[model samples]
Target: MLYQDHTSVVCKKQIFHTEFILRCHYYITTFDLYYTDQIQQTT
Candidate 1:
């Protein structure tokens, strides 16, 4: 029972971590695209 609880906790942490990484990647890509567009317009 204890082992099962520990595994569940680990699984939750891993899922949360993956979600955080995906969100960061999405934001970075969006910002990069916007910045590139602005630079292109100026040039």
Candidate 2:
């Protein structure tokens, strides 16, 4: 029972980590595009 609980916890952590990474990548890409647009407008 303890082992099963541990496995589940580890799996949850992995899922959370992947989701967090994806969210960060999404925000970073969106920010980059916005920044580029701003630069283009200034030029």
lDDT for every model?
1.00, 1.00
By summed lDDT, the worst window of 10 consecutive residues in model 2 runs over 1-10
My TM-score estimates for the predictions, one after another, are 0.95, 0.97
**Candidate 2 lDDT, 1-43, residue by residue in tens:** 9999999999999999999999999999999999999999999
| Cα error, candidate 2, residue 10 (Å) | 0.3
Runs of candidate 2 with Cα error greater than 4 angstroms are none
Residue 7 in candidate 1, Cα distance off native in Å: 0.3
Per-residue accuracy of model 1 over 1-43 as CA lDDT, tens digit each:
9999999999999999999999999999999999999999999
TM-score of 2: 0.97
Q: List the pairs of residues colliding in candidate 1.
A: none
